[model samples]
Target: MNRKKEILEKLAFIKSHKELVSFGVKEQEVSHNPCLSEAEIAAFERKHSITLPDDYRFFISEIGNGGFGPGHGLLPLNKAIVDFKLRDKPNISLNKEFPYQDDWNEEWIASFDWDEEYPDTEIVDAYISTAHIAGCLQISHFGHGCTFLLVVNGNEKGHIWFDGRADYSGLIPKMKDGHRISFIEWYVTFLDMEIENINKSLTNSTTD
Candidate 1:
């Protein structure tokens, strides 16, 4: 199928399935400050303006909380690191399941290159699986809207979905075409916090 047509179908499916997952956002918490506003997001009428897919928004908000880690228990964002490392290893089977399974075959993996081009620095990481050829995962923060933009690689721009809030500043990197890069910095941030909490718990257990 063509890129435009595929995106349209995905959008239609997502719009219809908004209720599949609970967004966890209290209707009363819609406050606005710097990054993004409900009004601004609502004003975005074109799909090219953002980097999120209609259905993928669930992964950031309702599916995995704001940041993609272990919120849903379905697919962990940490898995991306493993996938990237094993991209050229062997026996890689790209399955179309949640988190998208992979075995690391050179032929299948080498077909895709990570650093072939200077991607947007703002985008901390990007991912692609056999599930969707045109779609790609992007991590980036927009002003106060520290969200995820799961784009369609190089086709139509993409859509923007919330990934919670963080206090950050300065210019974030975007694609050469002027699109923002996905930010995967939170994955590491969350990993550190998880380790700290675990260590603290272990210490407390020993003392107790």
Candidate 2:
């Protein structure tokens, strides 16, 4: 079977259990939001002047629009757009180039004085822009201001990025085995982990 079909099976498996291992169960409960249609996906892409990554596009259209994903579940695509707008007062357009190709502010995350680091007005503007993480979808919120981003434009298009600006940690690519993590890889990894957790729970019950 194809990846989407495989994912569908896994989602079904996750739903079979009353007790789920993943977070966001209170809201999503292994149930998916309605799947988006191909036309709708196209419309969204046109509206934003972006091409949604294939895995993510397939996911929303073939699997689920949103629900039961990594980090407090996926936001429905439209909701993601709204979330992006609400959080970014500048209303950065999705078509804009994503500001970063790699991690920003990843080093020297230690005690510091802003006066020394951002000594100039230009640098201050850049510092503020770094936190925006423009040109992506705000797909998930892990609470405390942390969110997962799906890059729709720029060099990192099709990659998932983690924004930890909540703690001033900065934006970074989500990586596995030194390669940028794609949407399916990230989501399926979570599904497999949740399945394993359920299996372990079942085995323990049997042993008891």
Candidate models: Cα lDDT each: 0.32, 0.77
lDDT winner: 2
lDDT, residue 68, model 1 = 23
Worst 10 residues of 2 by lDDT: 83-92
- Candidate 1, 152: how far from true, in Å? 7.3
Give the worst 10-residue stretch by lDDT in candidate 1.
25-34
TM-scores, all candidates, are: 0.24, 0.83
Candidate 2, superposed: residue stretches over 4 Å from native: 23-27, 83-92, 106-109, 113-131
Per-residue lDDT for 22 in model 1? 30
Q: Write the per-residue lDDT of candidate 2 for residues 1-208, one digit (tens) a residue.
A: 7886798788888788747564455456777888999999999889889999999998888878988777788988877755442335454468887878878873444555766664465543555453357688888887776789888889898899997766668888999888999888888887898899889888999999
